[model samples]
Target: MPTASSVIEIPVPADQVWQLVGGFNSLPDWLPLITKSEPGEGGRVRHLTTADGGVIVERLQTFDNVARTYSYTIEQSPFPVSAYLATLQVEALTESSAKVTWSGVFTPAAGTEDAAVEALFAGVYNGGLEALRANFPA
Candidate 1:
């Protein structure tokens, strides 16, 4: 399995950032890569459409409001990955700052290059966090 991670510091309180990101289907609101996230399974599942027209289905595995974290597994996607598990966490750094970490582990799909797959996901995560930070500036 290959793992990729990205950490970003947001100039906002953790609770505030969590309010923006903690929802299982909130990706489209802040993530630049996702064009839309249609709700399903009573909001526990999201059918996400990427900006480049890729479709991905994901199921919320765990949601912890108090901990400001969530975990999800990709159920279906065009991406070259299998057994994808990803987590997003926000930690309070100060009264007006927070650290956000997004990470995932997955096995490279058949006929896919591991380095390419990892780089793609890392770019997605990093780009999303950068968009979030830009959305909420200090």
Candidate 2:
């Protein structure tokens, strides 16, 4: 399994960040790569059209308001990945500051290189974090 993680501190209360990230339905609005999202357990996310017009589907595994975390896995992906798990967590750092952690693990499908997959996931995760910063800038 290959894992990637990124952390960003947002100058906002945890509740505010939670309200945004926790509302999984609105991911496409902030995350450019997501073309559409259906919010709920077992909900799905569709990737935006890429140059190759590839498609991917991820299933919501868990959404916990108390923990301020959400988890999902790729139900259908174009990449050569046999399994994947992704999660986002929000932690209160202070009254006006919060930390967001995004991480994931993916086992490449047969004949795929783990390093390439890890790098791809790292880029996607980092981009998502950057989007959040832009959405809730200090």
Evaluate all candidate structures by whole-model CA lDDT and list the values in order: 0.93, 0.79
Model 1 / residue 111 / CA error / Å = 2.4
Model 1 residue 88 distance off true place after TM-score fit, in angstroms: 0.5
lDDT digits (tens) for residues 17-116 of candidate 1: 9989988888888998899999998989999998999999999999889999999999999888899999999999999999999999999988999999
Q: Report the number of clashing residue pairs per model.
A: 0, 1
Model 2: per-residue Cα lDDT at residue 6:
88
As for candidate 1, its clashing pairs are none
**Which sections of candidate 1 miss by over 4 Å?**
none
Q: How high is each candidate's TM-score?
A: 0.96, 0.86
Report the lDDT tens digits of candidate 2 across residue range 1-138.
Answer: 788888989999988888888865667667777766544444455333433456666677788889899998877777777668889999999998899999998788778788888888888889888988898755
Q: Least accurate stretch of 10 residues (summed lDDT) in model 1?
A: 129-138
